[model samples]
Target: MPGLLALVGGDEFKPGNEEQDRLMVAAAGAGPAYVVPTAAARQGPDQAVAHATEWFAGLGLALRELPVLRRSDAMKASLADEAGRGGFFYLSGGDPGLVAQVLRDSPVWRAMFGAWRAGAVLAGSSAGSMALCSHTLVRATWPNRFRRRAMEALGAVPHTAVLPHYDTFGHKWVESAREAAPDLTLLGIDERSAAVWHDGRWRAAGPGAITVAKGAKMTRFESGAEVKGLRQPARMLPGR
Candidate 1:
């Protein structure tokens, strides 16, 4: 009944947490952890599998790749059975829009939610990480051209937008996020470092930091905060 969601920004998976990672590799009781790499590999599934394999190895867990992003009922049923039965679930970095469009309103997405509620460790990275909020900051590539809209996120964390590659990338994210969802908590996760979330508290680990941007008031925390005391601002884009 306990789950861990390790939402990574980007990093080479280095073996860590030997036992914990091993348990994750075993996928516990949730069958084999579902690896959803739909965001990437519109080109091919091998890329996604490569990424997942490396990530799991770094986490000290071994994973079997599902390698499919279909919204079919059979896939949904399989995912539901996995959640009801037992391991972990992971989403590799790629295109957030793709992930959303492919999995939106489908049984697979629904099953994921149920698994999370049942305490399934749902780890992800980059695009995968971005798609875990109620309001997500999709693409922030074109500086001033930054745009954002509401999509059906995983709804795991409400009133939040995950800003990955915070420190690694320049301050572009800061500007874009400020223009997009200025009032929400913009969790700027750095590379190598992760925001380990559980029991409503998020603690940063690894050799990096996390930035918490709430409107004009923004600050970075080496160790992230719990969901509580995380000031929720009004739902308005910046310059309101």
Candidate 2:
């Protein structure tokens, strides 16, 4: 069996979300739970790791911080080898576009994929979550020409775009995204919440909820509720 996959909305490593992290730690087992801060490269990756370090410690799990801050670092053989030591791996928050750009087809990502296939828990929060999917919405930055758009991703979880931090301002961003591409499925996940894959079904984890809307019909799943009929994404199992 492939291990757990957590797609956290935003506000990762925060206190209220311990319910999901506890499950991750339990599933992770003895090996180190590596934290890859690649997405936070421009936004103080070290500080994010430090924050995560304190948070995971409280959960009694020590994290191996993988400092793959740039695309160059993602290709390193040394880091790739080190990544295999992880029983659980987390891709923290930052730029969705950069995370996908850096890690896709890289040696370190291959190792991480191998680990996840061997039953290691692979979790990603916010930008990390978006990059894990087949397509993701890139947040506006840089210049007027570089506002935002849907970009292709790694496809660990296929065929969807996530709107993180949904309970608040994240919902506001979705309108522009929906208008830009009306066909795409937007999974609006609330902050401090996560959509988790387990036991052949999707579960609404943590304090907040997961919302899926189709036309005028909107559906919401509260915490611990089973998300019925939600499209199940491909897993990193041993065989297809």
Candidate 3:
């Protein structure tokens, strides 16, 4: 079986979201859980690690931090070994563009994909989720003044882009994302919610809902709802 993939919206490591965390843990089987705080490194890894530690401790699981902060760290053989060993690997929230820029084509990223292909559960929250898609929405920096741009991502789930925090600020980017990549499926994931891939399709998990936007149509799938054929229309396009 392929490893379970969890793309969380945000607000992970909280009480109400324990069920989702537990699900990932259960999917991990016997290997240890590893938390990749690379995205949160700019904000401070210490705080991110601390948060993950507390959350995992609550579930009686030891949290191993993968310190792949910079591009240099992402290329280390030791970090790749640790990443490959994880039964469940999680990438926390932060700047999605930063995450992609640092980890793209890195040894650690290759190891992570290898581990996931080998049946290790993989989860990404907020920006982490964005980075996992084929095209990621980059929030504008101070100089850019709030512009959103679609950029290349990991392509773990190709032709898809995730808009985290959809219930709040994420909704604003929906139109821009559509205009940027009309053929791509844009998922608006609410906070504390997740879209998990299993049984050959993507299914909603957690408290909030998921919105699937393709061209001019937008469909909302509640928790536990099945999101099927999301890529069909795109595949039918002239140049897919």
Candidate 4:
């Protein structure tokens, strides 16, 4: 069976996001939800874990922390083993480029794929969400302007790119993202909102909306709305 995947905008472990959190737990059934704070490691993994723990506790689900912070940690057999047993695996928000670099071709990442294929819910927020796409948009700041560049990602979803926090700074990056990769479909997800992949398509969940942009046409989808034409193509990253 194909596993469930959720790409969230941001503000994951806060209030007002209870509904989507519950839905994710429900998708996983009866098992602990693994929290991967690799992206937030630079800021502080402990804080991120604490927040996720409290948030999941409100939903009556256990949150397990997988502290795969560095590239070496990603190669640890112990971490990989723990990651393989989760019912729901959540990737917290932080630096998207760093997340992609640490997990790319790592043992822990391979374990995550195996676990998800065997029936686990895989969820990512902000940078986490961006790292899962075939192409990732890395934002840079100069003396007077901000720049958006495209980079290689895990390719869990092929020919696709995600812009998290769309209700805020994400919207501004949409056009730049399109210009960077015109052939790829761009998804702008609002903060506290999610776009979940299930039943062969993506569906909007949570309070905010999801915007799908292709070429010059852009469409918006609200909660419970199904987003069509996001199927995985033949150009998916190897071993995806």
Candidate 5:
């Protein structure tokens, strides 16, 4: 079976999605799903753990924090185990840049790629979703008068960049993505919306839509669209 990928622009571990959660569980051969929250800048270790704890409780599922993610070695080891188990891996929303930095070239990130290739489900929202891209547009530089640097991203989906939080405050700067990676596909996920791919089709699930921008062509998909395995590369930049 094809692995499940829940790519949300941002905002997860909030409420609802019981049916979707059940569907994801079923997709993973009815095995227990792993609720891994990588996005969470405000909360500390304890708060982050507790937040996911409650979110999974509602679905009658257990949540485990890959604390190793905080450490390079431990994170890699944990991700290796996560891949071996063939269980679901859910990346919760927070800071996309931090998530990539924590997992870049680490064992956990390697395991994540392995799991995806092995047909294991990989789900994430907000920052988590952003990290899924080949080039993640992280909000490292706040772009204020005092801060004048662009955020660095961990490229997971090479040649493709992400435009996360398109419906949130981040929408204003999303256009700048073209300048970053002119030749790449832009996936703009909306809040409370999910971009799920399974069985060779991309299905939109939630109250919002997923916008794709390539050059000047911007299209929106509703709850149903067969976009699986489709290679939508980004538009090439000038002089590239």
Candidate 6:
């Protein structure tokens, strides 16, 4: 049994994200929740974990912090075993490249993946979301804030990429994202919002909307709505 999958825009552990987190809680059952603050290693992982624990506590989930801040931490068999026991696992925001580099082929990631494959909910916010896909847009190493380079990711969701914080800085990367992975499905999720995968379709959640960018047009889907494109090579919808 596969569990829920969510890619949230930036601003995790904030006021606006409660709605979506609540949804995760309902589907999560009684198993423990784990927050992987690996991405926030340089940005203060302890603080990130604290925030996650506090936020999820309000949601009735006493979240455990999987503080695997380095490659060494990721390789520890004990840490990997702990990662495999969670009913819900969250990857919080920070430097996406660091997250990928440390956890890409590590034991912790493998254990976490097994848990997810066995029906544990998996969600990532901001850079965490970006790194869950097949390819991630790398920005930390570059001097220019707006410029990004494509790099390998965990590939939990194949042929897909997310632009978190769309209402803020994410929209600026639209063209760059397209150039990086033209064949991939491009999703622009607004801050505080999320696109969750249940079954084979994606559903929009939270206070904001989700945008699926295609060619010269962008379509928006409000919360509770399923985001889908018209079937190709078929009867067109008016001029579309």
Count of clashing pairs, candidate 1 = 7
After superposition on all CA atoms, what RMSD does each candidate show versus the true structure?
5.6, 2.8, 3.8, 2.0, 5.0, 6.4
Per-prediction TM-score: 0.77, 0.90, 0.91, 0.93, 0.79, 0.91
Looking at model 1, the pairs that clash are 27-87, 29-86, 30-86, 30-87, 31-86, 200-227, 201-226
Poorly placed runs, candidate 1 (over 4 Å) = 12-30, 54-60, 70-75, 83-86, 140-152, 223-240
What is the C-alpha local distance difference test score of each model? 0.61, 0.81, 0.81, 0.83, 0.60, 0.81
Which regions of candidate 3 deviate over 4 angstroms? 140-146, 231-240
The residue pairs found clashing in candidate 2 are: none
Model 1 Cα displacement at 127 (Å)? 0.4
For model 3, residues 17-50, the per-residue Cα lDDT tens digits are: 7757777777784577888898898998788888
Candidate that scores best on lDDT: 4
Q: Which of the two candidates, 4 or 5, achieves a greater TM-score against the reference?
A: 4
Looking at model 4, residue 76 earns an lDDT score of 95
Best by TM-score: 4
lDDT digits (tens) for residues 1-240 of candidate 4: 657888899989998776677778888834557899989989888999999988988898888798889999999998888878777889999888888889988889878866777778888999999988887788755541235778888778888888899998888887778778899998899999998986567899989999999988999999999977575522224664
**TM-score between model 1 and native:** 0.77
**Alpha-carbon runs more than 4 Å astray in model 6:** 140-142, 229-240
lDDT of 2 by residue, 1-240 (tens): 677888899999888989888988888845678888988999999988998888999998898798888889989999999887679899999888888899887888878877876788888998999888777788555553223578887677766778888898677666667765566667778988999887677899999999875544568999999976456766542223
lDDT of 5 by residue, 105-201 (tens): 6666666555665666777777777776666675435544111123434343445555656677555655566665667777776676777766655
- Residue 55 of candidate 3: its Cα lDDT? 93
Model 3: which ten-residue window has the lowest total lDDT? 231-240
Clashing pairs in 4: none
Model 2: residue 34 alpha-carbon error in angstroms? 0.6
lDDT of 6 by residue, 72-130 (tens): 99999999988888789999999978888988888888777777777888899999998
Q: Candidate 1's error at 147, in angstroms?
A: 5.6
Model 6: lDDT equals 0.81
